[model samples]
Target chain A: MLEIRNLTASVGGNQVLNGINLSIQAGTVHAIMGPNGSGKSTLSNVLAGHPQYIVDGGEVLFDGVDLLAMPPEERARAGIFLCFQHPVEVPGVRMDHFMRAGYNAIHKSHDEEELDPIQFDRILKDKAKIVEIDPLLLKRNVNEGFSGGEKKRNEILQMAMLEPKLSILDEPDSGLDVDSLRIVAEGINQLRSPDKAVLLITHYQRILNYVVPDVVNVLINGRIVRSGGKELAAEIEANGYEGQGEALQPSA
Target chain B: MTTPDSLAQSEYKYGFVTDIEEETAPRGLTEDTIRWISAKKNEPEFMLEWRLRAFKHFMTLVENHQEPKWANVHYPPIDFENGVYYAAPKTNPASLEDVDAEILSTYEKLGIPLEEQKRLAGVAVDAVFDSVSVATTFKETLGKQGIIFGSFADAVQEHPDLVKKYLGSVVPYTDNFYAALNAAVFSDGSFCYIPKGVRCPLELSTYFRINAAESGQFERTLLIADEGSYVSYLEGCSAPMRDTNQLHAAVVELVAMENAEIKYSTIQNWYPGDENGVGGIFNFVTKRAKAAGNNSKISWTQVETGSAITWKYPSVLLQGDNSIGEFYSVALTRGYQQADTGTKMTHIGANSRSKIISKGISAGHGSNTYRGLVKIMPKAANARNFTQCDSLLIGDQCGAHTVPYVEVQNSSAHLEHEAFTSKVSEEQLFYCRQRGMSSEDANSLIINGFCKEVFQQLPFEFAVEATRLLEVSLEGSVG
Candidate 1:
């Protein structure tokens, strides 16, 4: 469902991602884990087409289309979703208006009939329930004063509403408490489908305990250092990537 | 904004002028200039004297003043001698049927057709073109309810007593420099009266359109709601595109007597200059309201989205014990436009209260400022006032400022002021656009949300118009 080949990118004249290759198939969940300054978050930002990140080399293919050629909005229209680690708080925009606009715009790109406010409200409420979001939050400004857990839940609510083909959760568990972590994992598990793919990025194994991954890759020094099964996480957990990654490799 | 209508993308939708013969006063401000305007309107002797008095005061101000250097706006010194103080279309149709077709079409293009105005329920319109009131609609129905709704000129000629009683009652001619100039040569504006104990059955509205070139429009509006009466008045004005700047200094006074309530809403789309700000209207207006008796209430709501330079503060005086006043404003300055608008709330009676909400938007090279004052008199014990001012900047090239003044003479008085300023960052824009909304749609959605508080104060029809006006006004502000 998604493919990245030799992707190299920079932000503010500093290299973030270099010579990275990854691919994910439908019906599978993949997790990327790495220490700080290891390019884990940059990988997701590059996939989301953040303008600040200059793509220095290579290409990305989503559903057999040149995803790198698309603008951020078009990438979103093509069913690519990025759940930000820290969602922005738009003080005046209502959550209902924001979600409805997303739903309508996504439907519009597919040349489908858009839902009216009343009709969209029903779907929105159902999605909010999937993530156990407070219905009252829907009426307030978008994440204006939402708690950390609520912001993560809102990203899930939007994901449920948009129903993208590929979902990238970028550190979605960073701000969640124990119960919220379970709820967020449960929400992600519910979205699992034969035609949908999930790429979970995280720094700890706490969330992996709830939503286990089929594949785990260790990223380091702007590149993926190793690709292995989910057991790779347990191994890294026990023996930190001190001597395993290229950082400890002998010069030349 | 929803679909990028050509009307929004166009430089200026209501920028076309109608060619017609006009009678213009001499292009100079002199004692005779004031008398010529008063004489042309066939004013009463007392009205002439009032104009003379205001003219002498205005001259004195012109000699000592420095063109209000305190406002957060810059413009070339106005050529007072180059603009005609009055210009009226040369046609007097005894009835709507005989009115000129060009004049009728002009109103139709502005989306207020006099013929169909009667078909509109609960809305009576008085269309003012240049310095004259063109045609007033739905008067008979309003007249049946003892409500007087018509041109100020007509009220001066027919209802002289009512006009004379409230003309400058709230905003005296000596109020400000602009008010003094407007008092000296003011032309036709809407005049409305709700009789005692009678609630007006319809909304009294006025549409001011400035079409003549090199002309200054000084309109005067007076509204009086008697004891136990209620009324709502809406004003919408615009002007055609012109290469030379036009002066628009108008005065509005509203009085709400014992147990009376008055609600006034304005959506002004005066001609804003081009992208570079070559020429536009310098709107210097003084709009004020007075709660004259116990339990009286007055509310002022304005959506100001045009003009090259806007310097106005629609204020209210809570003079009666337990009276209430409110001011809600949304001002947007795009391109090279500059606006310094807010409100004033003066509490003079015990237990009086006031509330003010202002939103300022600046995009492109535009500059927007919110300047407000809330004063509690020494005798106004237990008075209360709450003020909120928010500013939104769309681009890095724009500017926004908030200047608030609070003066309380009594220890028991309570005042609360809240202010916030934020920029339309790339993160917010990208977040909205990533959800598939176009940039324009996203920008307007954010803006509409910011202005929802003030927009709710407008009539339903005017609310939609205000939204559309903002969409078109800031069409090019967003990337």
Candidate 2:
């Protein structure tokens, strides 16, 4: 469902994602793990069409469409959802209102009927249970004065609302506690289906225990150096990627 | 949507005028013109004496005015003597049914259908054309509620006791140059009075339109919410395009009695001139509201998107214990328009509180500034204030400035002020684009998001209207 060919990106004239190439098919889950400043976040930001990231080379295609040519909102409407590491605090924009806007934007693009407040409330209430989020929080300003765990769960709630074709969880487990991690994992598991893809971007192995990926790719210095099955994640958890010289430059 | 080039060539939607205009004083600012206006309005002896005093003060203030160069706005010198001090619609019927159809049609063309606007605005409307109130709607219904809603001229004659007591009590004759001028030659504006303990059922609305050339619009609005009463008032303005700058000096005074609440909202869309700044209204307004009794509240919400040079500061005087004041504004200036607007919150009572939220957007070489003041007097112990001013600059050529003055004399008073100025980043735009939005849509979304805080303070209907106005005003320029 997604393909990246020799993606080289920079931010403020500094190279961040260098010569990165990856591919993932529908109904598959891929985990990209790397240390801080190793371009893990940069890769997610570039894929989500962040403006600050300058794409110097290569192209990205989603479902055979030129992904790079679309704006961030268009990309979102095209079913590409990015769970921000740190969700933006949009003051005065109620959570339900923001979710409705996102849902309508995507639904309109997909030629689906828009949900009114009543219908949306029913759907959002059910999804709220999956993420263990308080329904009352949905009525307040988006992410305003929310705890770290609440913000991460709100991100998952938004992801569920959009129901994107490709969901990129960029360190969704960063500020979550054990309970929140379980709730987030349960939310992702419920969202998993035969027609959707998930890209789990993380640096720790704790989240893998709940939502294990079908494939694991080790990213270092902008490039994915290793690609293997679920066992690869277990192996990396036992022994970090410090001494895997041969796997450092694995074939894309 | 029309292309930028087409819109630029299109004539203003409200460029027409009624031909039935009759009475008009000769263009000039002198004792004779002031006397003519006072006499035409049939003012009392004391009122005429007040006008003469104000006219004398206006002459002195104008000489030392110095044009207030500090504001980032420039306009051609206004010929005080060349402006018609008073121009009432030719036919003045005593009732709405007697109002001229042609003049009413002009209002209909302006999108303020008199009867419908009267219902939507809630309070009686004293619609002003050029320099006079053409018609007032819903006066009887409001009068039945024991609320005095009518034109200032009518109030001066009918409720002389209240008018003489409250007029100029908050803002004296020498308050400012514009206030002085308004006090001198002000033709007509709305006068509202809410009886004690009565929650006004309707929103009072006043529509001001400048239809004549070189005619100054000096309007005076007075709203008094009696003790324990509550009221909300709205004012809107627009004008025709003209080569020569037109002076618009209006004074609005609001008094909230003990436990009363007064909300004043203004959406000023005066003629802002073309990109080259050829012709526009020089809007110099003085609006002041006073919390006259304990626990009274006053709030001001304004969406200013027009005028070549707008210099106005709607202020609040907290004179009662635990009084509260709030100001929410979104000022947008584009294409040679300059706006230096904000509010002043004066805390003079114990435990008084004030909040000021100002959002400014500048594009197309326009200059927008937020100049606000928060003063906590020595007696205002335990006073609290929070001020947030944010500016969004669209193009590199435009400028956004923040000048906040805070004075806290009581050591127990707590004051916090924060401001931020930044151009929308390309990164944020790209992020939205990647989500499948057009560049224009993304810019609009971000701008709207930036203004969400202040917009939320508006009434639900006005919020939607303000958002649409912002979108239309920023169209074709959002990159």
Candidate with top DockQ is 1
Lowest-scoring 10 consecutive residues by lDDT in candidate 2 chain B?
A: B1-10
On the 0 to 100 scale, the lDDT of residue B404 in model 1 is 95
Off by over 4 Å in 2: A15-18, A243-245, A248-252, B1-23, B64-72, B116-118, B121-123, B377-382, B407-412, B422-449
Best by TM-score: 1
Q: Assess each prediction's global lDDT (C-alpha) against the native.
A: 0.87, 0.84
lDDT by residue (B103-165, candidate 1, tens digit) is 998988888888853345778889999998998898888889888888899999999999888
Per model, kept true contacts as a fraction are 0.53, 0.39
Question: Residue B410, candidate 2: how far off, in angstroms?
Answer: 4.7
Q: Model 1 chain A — which ten-residue stretch has the worst lDDT?
A: A243-252
In model 1, pairs of residues that clash are none
- Across A88-151, the per-residue lDDT of candidate 1 in tens digits comes to 7676688998888878988998999899999998888878888998788899998898899999
* Cα lDDT, model 2, residue B453: 76
* TM-scores of chain B alone in all candidate structures, in the order given: 0.96, 0.95
